[model samples]
Target chain A: MDLNQTIRCIVKLGGAAITCKHELEKINEENLETVSSQLRQAMNLGSCSNKVIGMDWSKRDGVLDISSSLADFDDQRQFTVDFSRFVVVHGAGSFGHFQASKSGVHKGGLSQPLVKAGFVATRISVTTLNLEIVRALAREGIPSIGMSPYACGWSTSERNVASADLSGVTKAIDSGFIPVLHGDAVFDDRLGCTILSGDVIIRHLAEHLRPEYVVFLTDVSGVYDRPPTDPNAVLLREIAVDEDGKWSVVKPTPQSMNMQVEITVAAHDTTGGMVTKISEAALIAKLGIDVYIVNAATIHSLKALRGELRHNIPDDWLGTVIRFSR
Target chain B: MDLNQTIRCIVKLGGAAITCKHELEKINEENLETVSSQLRQAMNLGSCSNKVIGMDWSKRDGVLDISSSLADFDDQRQFTVDFSRFVVVHGAGSFGHFQASKSGVHKGGLSQPLVKAGFVATRISVTTLNLEIVRALAREGIPSIGMSPYACGWSTSERNVASADLSGVTKAIDSGFIPVLHGDAVFDDRLGCTILSGDVIIRHLAEHLRPEYVVFLTDVSGVYDRPPTDPNAVLLREIAVDEDGKWSVVKPTPQSMNMQVEITVAAHDTTGGMVTKISEAALIAKLGIDVYIVNAATIHSLKALRGELRHNIPDDWLGTVIRFSR
Candidate 1:
C-alpha cells in the first residue's frame, strides 16, 4: 500500500477518558467499551453498514439535529470506507501516573535504585494497560497491535522527541493492522529518562504520517476556558491557528480582553494535562490538518471518528475543532 | 552500575521446556513456575540465602554427590552473590509456531494478506506468553521487563539476524532489571519477515554482552547421539570445540567412526529445532564461553544457573557441557 494514500487519521485517547484518574491503575471499563465499540463501528470491522440506524435524534440534547439530511437512506445500505487507515494513541492515565510521579521518573536519574525501580514499575503498569486495550480491540475484530515506544528506540532530549524508529508502526499499518501506541517512559539524552506523553507522540506521528485529520478523545466535552469543574467554565467550540503558529478563539467571541486560559494539571499527572494537549493540537493544526477534541463519553465522539464532524459547522456538535486559518 | 562487571550469564529457555509443543498455545505452567522459582533463587530477589540447607545428597542418583565439600557451612551464614547480572531468552514453543507455520510467516511474502495476518497473530501469541512469564517473575519479586525483538527493530536477512538494537537490554540490566526476550517474527531484509529463534538471540547477546556462561534449558537431559527417545541413544556428557570451530566428544569417547546423528523437529516447529540450538551453542563455545545444556524439569538446571556446575564434572550431573578446547 502507498503509505501516503493509505494513512488517513490519528486518534488520541486521553488518559482520563478510558481510565479512572482518581484511582491508581483503575480502568474505566464502561468508557473503554463504548470507545471500542465506536471504533469497531467506525472501522466497519464486522458486518457494519454505512446507513444510520434507528435513532431518536430529538432526544439528544445540546447537539445539532441532522435528521433531515439522512431521511432518504435505509439501514440496509452498505458503502465502502477506508477502515484500516488510522492509528490509536492512549494516555497513561491511572496506570503509570501514580508510579511516575512518586518516583519522579519524568525527571530521570537512573543512577538511583529507587528511580530505576520506578521506571520498571511504570513500564509494567502502562504496558499492562496497552495489552488490555489491544485485547479490547481484538474482541471487536480490529487487528490492533500494541507498539510501545520505549522498546523501539523512541527517546527524547530535553523533553523533546529527538529520535524514534517508526518503521514498525508503518509496517504494521501497511500490513492491514492498527498500531496502538501510548504515553511511555523513554530514554532522554540530557535528563537520562523522561515520560513521553501521548499528546507529543500524536503530534510526531501526524508530522511523519501526514494523516488527513486528528482526533482527541477526552473526558470532558472539549477544551474549556477555565477549570472544567468551575460553574462558570464555558467550552471553546472552535480554535484557529495562524501561519505563525499562533492560536485564537474562532467561536464564542471573548467577553474579556485577554485570551489567556487556565488549565490545571492533576497532582499525579507527570506529563502536562489539558494545556499540553491543546498545544500539541495547535501544532498539528499548523500542518493544515484539522484536529477535533470530543468527549469520549458521548456518541458525538463517534461522529467525529466517522469523519462526520467536518464540513459546515453544526450548532449541535458538542466538540472543538482546531484548523489553520490561512 | 558498570555493565561489563555486572553482566554474568545468559539463559535460553527452549520452547519445548515451557510449553506443550503438541498443543496450540498451551503453556507448561508447572515448568514455568519451577523455572521462575529457580530464577528468583538464583537472583536472590527474595529472602534467599546462599548457603545450601538440609540436603540428602546421597539419595540423589546420577549427579555428583557434594555433601562432603558443603559440610563445613551452616545454613545461617549468608554470602553475597551478584544476582542482578543475567538476561533471559525464551522460544516461541506452542504459542506461535502453529500460526507461523500455517501462515508460512518464516518464508516472508508481505504482499499477501495471509502472511501479514499471520505475522500479527504470531506476535499476539508470543507476547501473551512473554507477559505471563514476566508476571510469573514479578510474583517472585524479580523486576522482569518484556523486550520484544520485532517491536525494537531486530530483523533478519535470508533467515540470519541482520540487525538488532541491544541498548534496551543493556540499559535494563545496568539498571538492575532483567530483560526477557523471546523468539519472535521479525522483519527480514531478504525474505520480508522470518522467525528469529531464541538460540540465535542468545548467540547475539553472548557475542555482544560477553557473559560469563550460557545455559540452555530443554525438555530432555541434553544432546544425544541420536533421537532422544531411542532405547540405545546415549547423552553426550561433554563436547569441546577447537580453535577452528570443530566439535568432538570429549568425555563419551566415541566408539563409532561416523559421529553424524539424526534429530527430529516437531511438526509445528517453524524454526529449526535442536540442531539449530547445538549450532548456536557451538558458536558461543567458539567464543570461549562455556555452554551448559540441561533439562529444565530437574534441579540440575538450577545448579547450572546458580554457578555450581562449573568444576569437577560429576557423573551424577544430568546435563551436557560444551566448552572450547584451546
Candidate 2:
C-alpha cells in the first residue's frame, strides 16, 4: 500500500482553540487537555476498529510481523486501518505572536538586532509549545515527534511557502509515530525572515500528503455569516466551493446565499486571522478534499475526528463543511 | 567581519562529561550545572573583555547598532569580541544509548518494527535532554536554540556523514543565536538509519565553520597512554599531527614515542567511543585547528573555554592538546 494512502487526516489545532491568544505565552490548559483526550480516544477507536475487522498480527524475534493476508483484506477493511495514522499541525497563538509583532519579525529585517532577537525569541516560544503538546500527546500513549519547520529548512518567499521538506513527516507517519508541527519563524528569501502560519502549512500538507480529510478545530462553532459577535450572525453549517473559486451556503437554505465573510484579526495576530484560515480551507477543499471546521471546545468535535461525521450529520453538530462542488 | 570569524570556538559536551553514561537516561546534574556555569561565565567574560578593548554600541529605535568604529579597532581588540559566539554539540550518552543499542538502531534496519520504535524512542530521549540543556542555557541568559541534525536532513552513508545542511547553524550563528546540536539517530543511505556521533559532528563543524579552537569536555582528565584505569598509564599532555595525519605525543617525552593507543567502547555505546573521538580530533587537527580535551569537572576546563589556555597553560592544568605540527 502507498504510504500516503495510510494518512487518515491532517488535524489543525487553532491557536485560539488550544491557547489563550490574548495572553502572553499562556496555554489554555483545560482546552488542550480535552483536545488531547479526544485525540487519544479517536486513535484508540481506530486501532480497536481495525482489530474488529480481523487484521492479523504475529510477533517474531521481538518484532511485529503483519500477516500477508492484510493485503488481501477488502478495501473497506483497509480503509479502517488508515485512520490510525495522522499528522498534527498547530498555531503559535500567544506563544510567539507578541514577540513577533513587537519587532516586526513577520516583515523581516534581520539586519536590526531587535528583529534578530525577536526571530530567535519567537522560535523559542513556538518550539517550546510544540514540546509541550508533544508531551501531552505522549502522556496519552501517543508516540508524537515534534518537527520544527524552521529547523527542517522550511522557508517562505513573500509570505508563501517556497520550500518545505516533508520527508521527515512522511517517514514518521509511516513508522507509526505522529509528527506534530507548528507555526514558526522561518527564513524568507525576499524578507530575510517571516512567519509561516499553521493554516498555510495545512494547505500545503493537504496538497502534498492528500489526507482522507482535513479538520480545523477552532474556538467558535464554525464560520459565521458575519462577525461572530453580531446579534444577527448565524452559523453556516455547510459551505460549497465552485470550480471558479466561489463559495455558497449549502445548509439551512440561505435566504439570499451571497457569502460575504466578515473576518477580523486580533491585535496580536501577526498571521492573518480568520481570513487566512478560510482562504486556506477553500484552497484545500478545491483539491477534492473535504475540510471541516468545528468548535474544538465541544464534544461534537470528537465525532468529526473519529470519522463519524462523514456518515451522520447530527442536528446539534454546528460546523461548516467546505467541499469542492462536483 | 565575516559571520564565521565571529565564532570563537566549538564546544563538545561529551557524553561521559555531562551524563552518567553507565546508567540509563541518567544526567550528571552537578557536572552539567558546573559546565553551564562555566559556559555562562566564559560568555560574560567575552562581552566584558570586548568592552575593555573599546568596542562601541548604541541603541536606536530599540535596536542595538554597533558603531562603525568597531571596524577600526585594532586586530587584537577585535579578536576579543569574536570570543562571544560559539556553538555547542552534545553526545547522546545515557539518554539514547540503551534504546539504540537494544534495537541496533546504529546499524539500522528500519524495516523492523523494533528498529523503528527504537529510532523514535531514541529521538524522544535525546530531544528531551536537548530541551533541558537549552533551558539551562536560557536560565543563564544565553540565547541557545536546539537544532536536531536528523530533523534538518543530516544523514550518513557507511557510517560517514553524507549530507548535513549547515545553513540553519550558520544563520543562527550569524544572527547571534547559539545553535545547540547533538548526536542523533539519522537516516543512512546504506543502512536505512544510523547514529551520528557528537565527535563526528564536531569535526564536521570545525571543518566548515573554522572556529579558532575546539574543546572536548569529558569525565577523564585527558587522553592517556592506555586506559586511565591502568596504573602505569600516563596522561599525554599534548598530541601533534604531521601533514600526513600521523599522531605523536609531544609532551612528557614519551619513553618509546611509537604511539599505540588503546581505546575502549562502553557496552551501550553504539557509536564508536574513544576511537571515534580521537580519529575525529586528528582529522580536525589536520585542518590546522587546535583541539583541547579536558576534564569538565575541573576548573582548568573553564580556562580552556575562556581562551586563556592558548597563551598560558598553568602547571596544574591537565589536558591534551591536538594541533597540526607547524
Candidate 3:
C-alpha cells in the first residue's frame, strides 16, 4: 500500500454540520463537499498529507435522533460514512445527560466550574455516534469508519494507540481515503469522564499525521475580529491560544466570554470551545503542527501550512491562520 | 414488512461468545451461526417477545475485565460488557483501566473500604464500545441495538440532560426489535463514576419489561448443590432469593451457609451480577413475574415456563419459588 508521506490532513466536520440548528443543510452540504474534494485533490496531487474528514456533533446520540436519521436519503449526506477519505466521529450530547448525572461521577457541585461526572460517557457518545453516522454514510459507499478513546485511541489520560484494525482507514488512505474524527465525550480517569471535540481529536492526529494544516470547519464564514452581530465588532486574521489560557484569542468576533478565550478552558464545562481547541492545538504545534480555525462551511478557503492556498482564491479574501510555535 | 407475532425470547449470549481472551476468532463464526439459528427459531416459534441477542463485549464500548482476560479463555474470563437487554455497554478491561486511573480519581477510603482507584476513561470506553457493538450487531441484521442509561431513565442525579440521541432503542423495541444493553461504567452522581453490569441492567429492567421469566445464561449449567469443583457438588434444583437476602422460606441446601452468591449489591465499584440477579429477581417475583435462574450453557435441557414435562421433576428441582406478594 502506498501510504503518502506528504501533508496529511484530518478534517473534522463540526457538530454544527449535523444539527443544522440555526444553519442551513444545503450550506453544510456544499461546504463539506468542497472540503472533501479539496483535501482529496491535494492528496491526489501529492501536495497534501494523509487526508481524513470526520462528522462531529455533541447532542445527537439520542435513540430517536438516530432513528429519524434512518429516513435520510443516501447522497452527500452519505459522505458522513465514506470511509475511503474520511473516518467519522460524532458526539452524544442529547443521549442522557440527566441519566448520566444520576449515575455520573460528576455528582453535585453545581456552579463549581466544570464537572466531569457524566462527561466520559458524554464524549463517548460523540465518538460512537460519529461511527454510526459514517455507517449510514457508508451505505452509500462513502468509505468511512472511526477510532476513538473507545475504538482506537484519542484518549484523555494516557498515550494514544493506533487501532489494530487500521485497515478500515489504512486501505482507504492507501486508496486515497479521508479519515474523520470529531468532538467526543471520552472516559476520563481523574473526573469520571470527559469530552474530546472534533477540534482536539484533529489536533491530536496532527501530532502524528503532521498534516500541513488543521481546520475547524464551522458554520461561520471565518473567525470575526468582533462579534458579527455587533456592528463595532472586529475580525481577527489569526489568534493564538495560550496553554495556560492567559492570553486573549478572538474568534473574528467575540460573541461572549465563551466565544473568546477565558480563564478556565472549555474542556472543563465543555462550553467554552475555542480556548480548548487552541490549547490542544498549541500542544500539537510544539510537535510541529499548524492549524486553521476557519468557517468549515467555506471549504474554498482552506490553506496550507506554508500559507499555500488549497483553492484558487484571492489572497485578500482568504481565511485567517493560527500557527503554533515552540 | 410483515412482522411476526408469537412467543419471542430475549436471549443474552454470554460475553465469551464475542470476546475470548485467548482466541477471539474461535467464537465469532460459531457464535454468529448459533445465535442466528436460535434467533430465527425463536422468531418462527413466536415473535411477541422479540428474539434478540447482542454482544456483551460490544465493539463500540470496548471491554473491562477486573483481571486480565488474556489468559485461557474460560479460566478467569471476568471481563465482558455487561448491560441490560437494551444497551450493550462494553469496556476494554486491562487496556483501559490503567489509562483511566492514570488520569486520576482517588480510589479508596476509610469506612467505605479500600477505594481502588478505578480508571476514568473506563466510563467512556464502556459505553462507546457497547454502542459500537450494538451497531455492529444491527448491521449484521441481528435486529438488535444497544441502549444507553440515559434512554433507560437512569438518572441518579438531577439535570444535565445528555445531548446524544437515545430514542433509538425505544423505537427498536416498539418496532419489535430487541434492544440490548450491557454493563457500562458511566459518570455517576454519588460515586464519581461507577461500573454498571448487564446483570444490574437486567435487574433494573425487571422493574419495567417485567418478563414472565428472567433467566441468566452462564457458562456453567445451574446452581450446584456443592461447589462444581467438588464433583460431588450436586446441582441445586432451585434456590429462591427472598426480598431481604433471607431465603428462610426454603430449606437451605446441604452446604448452603458456605454458599455465597457472587454479586455486588452496592452500585459503586461493582456491576450487577449473579448475586444481584437473584435479588432483582426477587423483586420481579413480587410483581408476580416468574424468573428462571439457570446456567444457559445447559440450556439444551431448557424448560419453558409453560412446558408440561416439568411436572415430572422433583419439587426441589422445580425451584424454591419465592412469592412476591407485596
Candidate 4:
C-alpha cells in the first residue's frame, strides 16, 4: 500500500470550512459539495499540476478565448489519472472543538479523571463527522475510507506524532481509494492523552510522503494581514520563505496600487485559528512543497486550486500561496 | 482518568453472544438487551463481589425470596459504584470475521498489496458493529464510550499486542463510563495490517489492568471436554491451571456419577470457536483471576455471572469457571 511515489498532492478540508463551527454538530453541505466536486475534477485531470506549462487560453480586449494551440486537445474530454493519488485530511470543526475545548483534551498533559469523559465525547463527535463526510464523498462517486488518527497515530512524550502507521493510508491511496482522516484524541507518552489537529497531521504527512502540493480549503479566501477584520486589512496573495528562512508577503506597491486586496478577515476558530495554520504551512513550505490556503465558498476558488482556470494565473485565484523560493 | 485500582472486572460480549454470526450484519437484539440489563444490574450492586458477603435474598424450595436480612437495605435502591469501573470488549463477529478470513487478516503476516482493500472493508464492518453496540448500551442507560483497538492497540512483529495504551480506557472507567472496545484492523510492524481479535485484546487488557474477574459471555454454556458439537461431550464446570501451568478441567467420575453436566454444545463460532476462547481464558486464570464462560441466550446466565443469582455456586450455574488454585 505504499503510495509515496504516486500521490503528488495532499488536500485538507478544514473543519470550519466543511462544518458550521458555531452550530453544534452541523455540516456545511454546500461547501462540502463544492470541495468534493473540485477534488473529483482535479483527480480527473490526470497528472496535471498548477505549473501552467504552456498557454492554452489568451485574453484580448478584456475577453478570454481559447487559443489556436488548444485546437489539438479536446477541452471537454476529461483526462483520467493513472489513479486518484491524493490524501484527504479534515479538521474536527464543531464535532471536536467544543468537547475538546471544554475538556482540555487539546491542551494535552495529565488531566483530571473527569476529563476522560471529554476525550470519549470528543472522539465520538469527530468520528461521526468523518463518517458523514465520507458518505457524502461516496455519494459523489468517490470511494473514500474514513479512519480515525487514533486508530494508527501515536504521539511522543512531547505530544507530537512519534510513530504513525500509515500503511493503511498508503494502501488505500495505492488502491485508488481516497483515505479520509480527521483530528482525533490520541494517547501521548508524556501527556496521557491529547488532541491531534488535522493541520499538524497534514504537515507531518507531507514531510514523510513528500507530496508536491498541499491545499488547505478554508472559509477565508486566504491569509490576511492584521486579522483581515481591520478596515485597511489586505490579502497576502503570495507568501514565501526568504533565504534567511523568514516569511515575506508579496504586496502591491506604487508600481501596482491599482490592485485591490481580495481577502476578508478570518472568523474565530477554536482550533488555534488562522495564525496556527500559517505557521504550520510555513514549515511545509520550507520542504520545497507548495501550500495553498484557498476559500471553497465559490466554485471559482475551486477552479483556481484545481489548475483548471489558469488563464488568470495568480491574479484570478482567490487564495494565498506559501512556498520556498528556489 | 486513572483506573488501575478501581475497576475489578472485565466483561467481554462475544460477537456470537450478542450478534447473529451466521447472518451478515444482524444483531441479536433480544440477547443484547438481556446482556445490557444484567450489566446495569451488576453496576447497581456496589461493592458486591460474587462472594455475596451479606445475603440479600434467601431460597425456599427452588424459589428466590427476599430475606429479612435485607430489610435494612432498600430493595428498590440501586447502589452506584464510586465509579462504574468495568471495561466491555466485543468481537467483530460477522462484521469482521468474513473480511478478515477472506483477506487473511487474522493469519498474521505480510500480505499481498490487494489485501489493503480488505483491511479498509473490515474496519468499516467492525466499526459499524461497535457503534451499534454502543448505541444499545446507551439506550440501557449505560454511558459507554466506543473505541476501536486500532486507536491505541499496537502489535509486535509476530502480531501479538506489543504496546497498547489503555490510559483512555482506564480513564473512561474511572470517570464512570463503560469503555467499549471491539476487534479491529490494526497496523502491525511485521504484517502491514492484521486483525486484533477481541479475545486477544481482553487478555492484553487484563495483563495490564489486573482486573479481579473476567466474564466471557458466549453463545454456549461453557467449555467442554471435546468440541461441544460431539455427542459424548460433557461440560467441564471448573477448569484450572495445574502446578506446571497446564490447563485441566473437572469431570465427574463413578463416585460422582450422580452429578450432572450443565453445559450444552456450543454453536458456530467463526472467531476461533470456543476452544480458542478457553485457551485465552486459561492464560488469564493463571494470573490469579477468575474467568467465567456462560451463555447469553438466557437472562439467568447473565445474572449468574453478575453474582445476582448465586445460590448453588459453580454447581448451580450453567457455565464453566476458570480459576487458579491457591
Residue-level lDDT of model 3, residues A23-135, one tens digit each, is 21112345445544544443334323332222221123331121222233222222222222333334333332332343332342211112221232233334344544443
Worst 10 residues of 4 chain B by lDDT: B51-60
- In candidate 2 chain A, where is summed lDDT lowest over 10 consecutive residues? A52-61
Name the top lDDT candidate: 1
Per-residue lDDT tens digits of candidate 2, residues B42-99?
Answer: 7667264433211112122334333342344344332232227789999977887776
Residue pairs with backbone atoms closer than 3 Å in model 4 (clashes) = A113-B1, A150-B151, A151-B150
Clashing pairs in 1: A63-A316, A64-A316, B62-B316, B63-B316, B63-B317
All candidates' TM-scores? 0.80, 0.79, 0.41, 0.69
lDDT of 4 by residue, B165-261 (tens): 7765775565456778888877676766678888999999888888868888888787765566767767678777765557665544424533333
Which residue ranges in model 1 land beyond 4 Å of their true spot?
A1-6, A22-26, A40-83, A256-272, B1-6, B20-26, B43-83, B256-272
lDDT against the true structure, each candidate: 0.75, 0.74, 0.39, 0.66
Clashes of each: 5, 0, 144, 3
Instruction: Tell me how far the alpha carbon of residue A241 in candidate 2 is from the true structure, in angstroms, after superposition.
Output: 2.3
Higher-DockQ candidate among 1 and 2?
2
Model 1 agreement with the true structure over A1-326: per-residue lDDT tens digits: 23745577799988899998886677798999889878867766444454322211111222423243234434313322225578999998888876687668899986553455457667877887887787666544466778889887799998999998887788778756788999998888898889999999999999998887899999889877766676776788888999998888877776652444532323213343666677789999999898999999587898888777667667899999999999
Displacement of the residue B247 alpha carbon in candidate 2, Å: 2.5
- Rank order (by DockQ, best first): 2, 1, 4, 3
Measured by DockQ, the strongest candidate is 2
TM-score (chain A only) for the predictions, listed in order? 0.84, 0.84, 0.57, 0.80
Instruction: In model 1, state the lDDT of residue B254.
Output: 62
